[model samples]
Target: MPKSVVSLWLLVSACTTSPSHSQSWDFELRVVARGLQVPWSVLWGPDGWLWCTERPGRISRIHPETGEKRILLSAIEGVYARGEAGLLGMALHPRFTDSPFVAVAYTVYSGFVELRIVRYRYDASRDTLLDPQILLANIRVGNIHAGCRFLNLPDGTLLLSVGEGGIPALAQDLSSLSGKVLRIHWDGKVPADNPIPGSFVWAWGLRNSQGLALGRGGLIYGSEHGATTDDEINLLQPGRNYGWPSVEGYCDTPPEEQFCRDSNVVEPLYAWTPTVAPCGLAYYDSALTHLPQFRHSLLLATLKGSTLYQLRLSQDGGRIEEVNAYPLGLGRLRDVLVTPDGRVFVSTSNRDGRGAPQPDDDKIVELVPKNQGIEDTEERSLLRLWCQERQLWVEARAPVTVRVITVCGHVLVEWRGLPQQRWSLQSLAAGWYGVIAWDGVRREFSPIVVP
Candidate 1:
C-alpha cells in the first residue's frame, strides 16, 4: 500500500511454456478498428473518444463501444511518410473543452526532414482541425531515433522528450535542440524558470527517449533506447545529463564513472540488457478513477521486445518496486493507453516495414479482463458484486469481509471494509469462483464465471 514499497518490487515473468501462462489468455484481446495504416499514437480523449494518429499524416476519432471510426483530420500536406517519420505524438490542450486546441508532432519533408511541433484548433461543428500554428520547428528529423513524446504538465507547460535524432553527439551538445527534453509554454515560448538561460532544454544527454512519465511523489521517469544493451529507465531531473553516448545504462565502469563524476551525470533507475526498445510510457496514479489495482504503477510498450510492461512504483515514486512483463504475440507495439474507466488499449506498429504484418497489421486492440459484469444481490440493494467483462466490482455501504474463493474451496483474495472495490481478473484462469461478503449480521455469496 505504501508508495516506496511498490517501486522496489520487481517481477520477471517470461512468456514461455508454463501452466500458469494460460491465465494471460483470460484477457480478451479485441480489435476495435482495422485497415489502419500504421497507427502510431493513441490516447483517450477528453471528449470520451479514442483519438488516434496514423503514420500517414491523418487523425481519427474512434468510438470505444461501436468501433465506429471517423477520420477527423487528414490531407496533411508536407508530411514525410518515411521510416520513423510522419505524424508522431499528439496531446489535447488541458482546457480542451474551451480552447479546443491540440498539439501534434510530425515530420515535414522538403529538401530535408524536420520534426515540427504545432498547435491546431478544432472546429467541433465541422469535425475538422483548423488554424495550424507551428510551435517548435528547429528540430532536425532523422530516419530513426526521432524521439518526440509529449507530457502535458499541470503547470500549463508541456514537457517534450526529444531524441538525439540518430546522432549520438547531438545528445551532448547543448546548442542543438536534439536529444533533450524541452519544456516550453503552450504558446511556444521558453519558460523563464528553465535550467539553462534562454534555452528550452530541461534535460539533455538522451538517446531516443520515447517515454516520459511523471508519477507520484514528484518523480520524473523516462525511457530510452540503447545501442545493443543498456536500454534504460531514468529518474529525470532538470538540467541533468542522462549519459547517452559516453555512458549507457549505469556509470559503473571506471572510465564512465570518471565522466559521470566530472559531468554530474545521473544514472537510470532500471535498464534492460537485451534492449526491449521501450516506447509509450504511462504512469498510473490517483488520477485514474477506474483501475485501482493499476494505481502507483507505470506501464510501457516495447517495440522489438513486443511486450507490455507494468511496473509498480513505490510510495515515494523514487524507486521501482516490481515489474510485470506481459508478452504480446502481436507484432511491434507502438503505444499503450489507459482510460479513466480502466480500459487499456494498444496500437500495433507491425505495418512499419520492419515488422511482419498480421491480417489487421496496424489495428488498435483493447485488452479486456475476463469477468466483465458484476452480479447483483437481493439481500441488500447497496451491497453489490458486479463484473464487467474482466473487472469485478464490489460495492458495499458498510464494513464487510470480502473473500474471493475458487470453486475448489481455495481462497484467492480477501479484503475488509471497502466502500467500493475493484479487482482485475487478468491473472485468473477461466473457472467458476465465488465472492462472499460477510457482515456481522448476514452472509452473501456471489458467483463469478470466467470464460
Candidate 2:
C-alpha cells in the first residue's frame, strides 16, 4: 500500500475552509467510551441515547452525560465472526419512537455463511431487545469483502450497501446480491417501484462499499474501497452502474471508457490514487452544528488512512466545493455520527487485527467546536443544562432569555431570568427539546432529552 497525501482548501471561504479559518470553534477531542472489540456502526438514538454496534456481535448503549457503558445485547448468536465478517451494521426504524425497531446486519451460518438483516423490538423500559425477526437473508458474504451499512430514507425505505465479497465478477452479476446496493421496504419487502422488477437492487457494480450517506436535495453519496488505488467517493444514482472490475475510479483508460459507455456506468465524484479505505459517511445539515461551513459538508471516516475528511458540497449538493482532511492521530476510524447538539463522535477500529491498538484498544471520541462560557463542566457554580433533569440551572453571569424549542422547530417556552435561576421544563412534553440562550447578541444552544 502506498502512502496517501494530505489535502485541504486553505483559500476557500470561511464556511468551507478547515478549522484553521474558524476561531469560533473551540476544537476538543476526548474519549467517551473505550475497550471495544471492533465497533462498527454508531448513531444517536431517537431518545438522545448513544448506541453502537460491535463487530464482535453485540450492541452497547452509552450514557451521553457520564459516558457510562451498558451492554444492550451481550452477543448475537449465529453471528459468524471471521476476517472482516461479523455483526457489522445497525440502524433504527425511521419512526423509532413509535416503531421501536432496531435492525442489525450480521454474517449468519447454518449450512453456509450468509449475510442477513435482522430486526428486533427495543423495549426501552426493560432496556432489552425483543422479538428478533430476519427481514432480509441469504445474501452471499465473504471474509474480506462484506460491505454492510444501511440508511433509512425519509419515506421508510431502507438503502443497504452490499459488498462484492471479494469476487470481482459478482459486482456485475446482478443475479447475485454481492457488490450492489439494495433498496427495500421497512418490512423487508421490495419496493413496488423497484428499479428492477421483483429485485431489491437499486444499483449494481459496486466494489466493497464501506460508507453510505444521504445528502441534501435527494443526493446520495457512497465511499467505495477500490481494488488498490481507486478508492472512490461516488454520487449514487438510481439504477446506475458503478464500473468496478471494468473501471476502477474514472474512465481514464480506453477499455474503461468502453465499459462505461457499454454499461452506462457512472463515474465517481472524487477518488483517491492511493486507497484511503474510506469507511463511514455523514452529512452535516443542522444549525446545531454551530459551524456554518460544515453545515453542508460530508464527514467521512477512513481506516487505512486514519483521517476524517470533510467534503464541502455545493448549496444544491450537486457539486463538491472543497476537500479538507483531519488527521485523527489515533487509529483507524470505523464510524462517525453527529449529535443534535453539533458534537461529532467517531469510533476507532484499531483492535480489528489491522492497526496497533492503544491502551484501551478502541474508543468513541467527540469532536467539538470552540465553545464559550461554562468552562468547567464538572463545576456547578456556573450553569448547566441537564437533559435528563429537564432543567437549566444558572449561576448569574448575565441576564439571558432561555428558549426551549422542539426538534420540530416549535418554541415551547421562553423565560427571561437572571444567571442564578432555574428554568423548569414542566410545560414542555416528554421528548428531546433544543434549548437556546440569548444574552443580547450572543446565543448558545443545548440539547435536552426529557424522560
Best by lDDT: 2
Report the Cα lDDT for residue 443, model 1.
43
Give the TM-scores of the predictions, in the order they appear: 0.77, 0.77
User: Each prediction's Cα lDDT score?
Assistant: 0.75, 0.76
Q: Which ten residues in a row have the lowest lDDT in candidate 1?
A: 1-10
* Model 2 C-alpha lDDT per residue in residues 201-247, reported as the tens digit of each score: 99999989878888877789999998779989999987899998899
- Residue 352 CA displacement from its true place in model 1, Å: 0.6
How high is the lDDT of residue 356 in model 1? Answer: 60
Residue 158 accuracy (lDDT) in model 1: 88
| Pairs in steric clash, model 2 | 15-293, 25-370, 26-369, 26-370, 163-179, 396-419, 396-420
Q: In model 1, what lDDT does residue 107 have?
A: 88
